[model samples]
Target: MDGLLLQGFFRSSAAWRVRIALNLKGIGYAQVARHLRRGEQRAPDFMAKNPQGLVPALEVPGQGVLTQSLAIIEWLEETQPGAPLLPADPWARARVRSLAQIIACDIHPIQNLRVLAYLKRELGQEGPTVDAFARHWITGGLAALEQRLATEAETGLFCHGDAPGLADLCLVPQLGNARRFGTELSPYPTILRIEAACLALPAFQQSAPDRQPDAE
Candidate 1:
């Protein structure tokens, strides 16, 4: 609970997800900005913390370091337990995980910083081309998510029945990336509606990249 250090980038969606989870649980943390664009994650200090050289590696005072967004979020939920991120029921929890994974597993990994950098540096692709590919994948994934949310009866104010849970946390940041890339979200009315609802809450608002200390 003390000296919680968050090693993260301002615009990194994975980092953003953890920030939202922390805010939702009312956990206080000190943020150490990692500049992803400047290749700071590969520095000796950060690599020592996370050998994979990824942003959003969390350091807790007594528990060592934690990596991966979903794992960190679950760890926070288990340790804190006040504002639970997942549902209490087993089946409902599974559904929430499924929804969250739709974005986290399927969409985010494809458009991650490393992947984009690889496309430009290794594949000899230009910025516009790589950006187009990212947009295509994100748009496709969000389209499916929009359809599911619109038709599912469980979808209410948020992704899962009126509560801002795991799925909404993932969805909001992905939507932010989509908007940054000029991916027209007007097609996904359900997602836009849900995002609007989530943004109305203080937790999501405060966790936004623009509100961060490292934000430009």
Candidate 2:
């Protein structure tokens, strides 16, 4: 199979998730950078690929375009099953998905690039104010995550088990965003510990934003 074409920005958390997923699955792909800060995602060419004009759109060789980070990651899990991100058991899979969705669906969308841009441009908010708003939501969500992970029996070296999985993938990128915004993550010891464990893995380390070819 021809390698997939990934159109994404290096610093985008959604894009980062897909990158980590691809690396974990050992899937070879070509990354085409669409710098968000330069408004490249809104260009006519990118819009032709993703009408929504979102970064992290995957152009599968013959299967057409795939949008949304979670969708793309799920596709990778289905198509490339060597390194399974989800658990084998039904209940375990649900638990992992629940934790992942808390970050992906609940926290991420509210603080994504489009949301931040809207806050700044549409609402006339300043950078500091928008950043503070992002940190507020991130901290709140992380607090809840910490509560679950710290108290739950399932929490191990990673978010779910001793091995890194879907929850870890979602957690690491969100933590990266939180740290970028100067959010105080020290409050969540469990999260910090899990993040450290994930970073020890080559897949997560290699897929980090700074390690990307297009990283500034």
Candidate 3:
């Protein structure tokens, strides 16, 4: 097909983030459901598309496959002709990128599937220990983010402003991951408020994990 194709797994926060961006940008794309738990991402055919064997890889019609959720979203922002994912102001754009990186770079890697798999299989960590490990990192990251979103004057209805941007895409999915790991979220009022605002939109509502075709 000539349309965009998204390589993703249901319940993947990174994949979820991309889905939100696509929806927000009003892009039409097909989905290749790679079951991360079943090792579908590591399959040879899938690996050919993404050497890293990760979900949220985007296959452009003319261009080659794009890996990394943020990179894919940025590409969409640049090429697509829909919603604006970044602001006009350079400083605001930098702030949004910074907020997004807190989840993409700092929080996500530690609790990634590969890392958790290593902790469980290689290190022989028990269920509770592995779970605790995820919760610890997620909680700490949210705590820091909550402080910034609360204290910063730039914060409005969303992470950067009234409109959802790159940071909101990251924050919403990370919050979903946080809830999955049973992280108590009441402490982060600002984050929760932003999430509520995001969820109120059709884009966020439609892109949710539970709404995905492969959700289980």
Off by over 4 Å in 3: none
Predicted model with the maximum lDDT: 1
- Candidate 1 global Cα RMSD: 1.0
- Whichever of 1 and 2 has more lDDT, that candidate is 1
The ten-residue window of minimal lDDT in model 3 covers 1-10
Candidate 3 residue-wise lDDT, 1-216, digit = tens: 249898898889999999999999887888989999999999999999988888979888787899999988888888788889999899999999999999999998899878999999999999889989999999888888999999999999999878998999999989888878888999999999999999999999999988888999
Query: What tens digits encode model 2's per-residue C-alpha lDDT throughout 19-44?
Result: 88888887778899999989999999
**What is the per-residue lDDT of model 1 for residues 1-216, given as tens digits with 9 covering 90 to 100?**
768899999999999999999999889999999999999999999999999999899999988999999999999988885688998999989988998998999999998878988999999999999989889889989988988899988888998888799999999999988877788888999999999999999999999999999998
Quote the lDDT for 55 in model 2.
85
TM-score of each: 0.97, 0.96, 0.97
Tell me which residue pairs clash in candidate 1.
Answer: none
* Model 1, backbone clash pairs (residues 3+ apart or across chains), number: 0
TM-score of 2: 0.96
TM-score of 1: 0.97
Taken over the whole model, the C-alpha lDDT of each candidate is 0.92, 0.90, 0.91
